[model samples]
Target: MTAIQLESASAQSKHEATLPELGLVCITVSQEVRFRTITRTRYLQFDQKERKKALKSIYEDNLQRLNSALTFCEKHSIKLYRMTSNLFPLCDIEDRIGENLLESMSADLAKIGERAAKLGIRMVLHPDQFVVLSSEKPQVVENSINILQTHARIMDMLGLPRSSWALMNIHGGKSGRGKELIEVISQLPENIKSRLTLENDENAYSTSELLEVCQNAGIPLVFDAHHHICHEKLDSYDDESVTEMFYAARETWDNPDYQLVHISNGKDAFKDRKHSDLITDMPSCYREAPWIEVEAKTKEEAIAHLRDWWEGET
Candidate 1:
């Protein structure tokens, strides 16, 4: 039903394919039901051997799906994808699964990365919300570092250069902690630091706050346009602020054209934070960043619909 996956397209479809309109970045296929969606690791019967087996299988499935996703993106002309952090989820027992996993899946990772590289498709990782660096507690920060280290190792295994396309994006955790978060980011290994990007949160860090963090850390900023609409107050952030936000974010990238943005629409008027199944319009402040991750419930299908809609306007 999505516009991107149409079976029968008239002359309009062919003309639309050549237009440079919105950069609709997709995250995996939308048909999660029809697709073999694998989210969590299954410990069949909690048996030790079974647990290890399950972990290996999940890792393999994730990579396969990632390769499949890359192919899907290339076919649909979607260039950017946000990879799932659940790829390994072995952080609970990294001692057991970390190095062993690298050795086991190195080839597959390399091959998959090669596929992505060849197709000129971009990939990124958004570690879940649990990864909080603003916590004053040492263990929480330590755990967060360890998790990102694991993510860095996977990025290395994939042979993705330390760049924005192969980056680890996170939010400014615990409001008023942007400075502290930058200090933590400073201490990270060069490999991890180079690939880190900070995003503005809905309630905590606004466009103005995270801008400083990214500047200090020498990393790019990912502007979530929907969050601005949903969480930012009219009196606080003005049209000029929106313009500055986009400029600051795009400045962080090596090539300004590769700047990434997150786009989504609210499901309802009252619940603006909730992502709608389809995004019908781009924010007025947005001016076609080089890359934009469409944060819609419909996933790839939504990108297709956007493509179809954009073609009509062109």
Candidate 2:
């Protein structure tokens, strides 16, 4: 090859080797809500045969898309990702597919996990807002447990060791009953609890409140910067608080060396809870955030914009 070609290849290798793993910007399965809803509405279909067929078809498609998403993350050097909540819509739909669902999805899931492992791509799973483990109602907690179990199953299928990288974040749940919240999380099966993390919710719980809950529950805290800003539960927070909390979260994990944080911007004129297309400004002392999950509307586009902004500021 020419001298120019050799130099270009060397430079590319050097860049990849030194790329700072500040935080892995992630993208969900699909940015478009309606488009990502690959699963068809099965309740309306009365025939069991048709419903089973639909279920299998949707799951197969979701898994294929999921594999593709993982590939995308690897290509972009995004070391962290949030799996589509509905990747496997029904917890037990695998029953219809004959042999155990985990067994069926094992090969595909393992393949994705292997790819992620090679690239050090951490997968984060967030159940829908409906998961309320600390709710006063027993049914809510029970159902939430079922969801948690499904997440745990996914972790097992991935064969990734029980670590923060395979985090399944849940809010502190109901507003009050702090003790119950701790107790509820404590009661979860060890497998489910192992990869579990408590994220600060905007309306439901404050960062400090959930931090305490996570401490009491013996789990790490996944601080949500946007939620913390919008949270009225606390009077105020400052730069020091951010650093303290960042470390506080770090201490809760076995691998404190790498902490995962969550971030998002408002969709409108100001910083509201709604996720915007991109974050114009970084959160206070964003450097403290070891690993961040950008929950912005535009997903990867938002990350790309933030990277450009971050580079300019630095």
Highest lDDT: which candidate?
Answer: 1
True-structure Cα RMSD, model 1: 6.8
Q: Candidate 2 at 152: error in angstroms?
A: 1.0
Q: Put down candidate 1 lDDT per residue, 1-314, tens digits, no spaces.
A: 21111212211333444442233332444543122333334443456666666677767777777777777777777666677777665634634753586577899898887777666666788988878988888899998888888888888888877766577888888888878898998899877887888888789888878888888878889888667655665322235666677777888776565467888877885237788888786655564455567888877778788777876877
Query: Over the stretch 1-314, how does candidate 2's per-residue lDDT look in tens digits?
Result: 32223324433443444222333333442552221343335433436666556656666777777777777776777766777666676644434441244467688877777666666666778878888888999998888888778778877787665655577887887897789999988888887888889888778787788888888888889877667767743333354565567667777776553467777767874446677887675556556555677777777777777777768866
Provide the global lDDT of candidate 2 against the true structure: 0.67
Against the true structure, candidate 2 reaches a TM-score of 0.83
Backbone-clash count (model 2)? 0
Candidate lDDT (C-alpha), each: 0.70, 0.67
Candidate 2 least-lDDT 10 residues: 2-11
Residue 243's lDDT within candidate 2 is 56
Q: Supply candidate 2's per-residue lDDT for 141.
A: 88
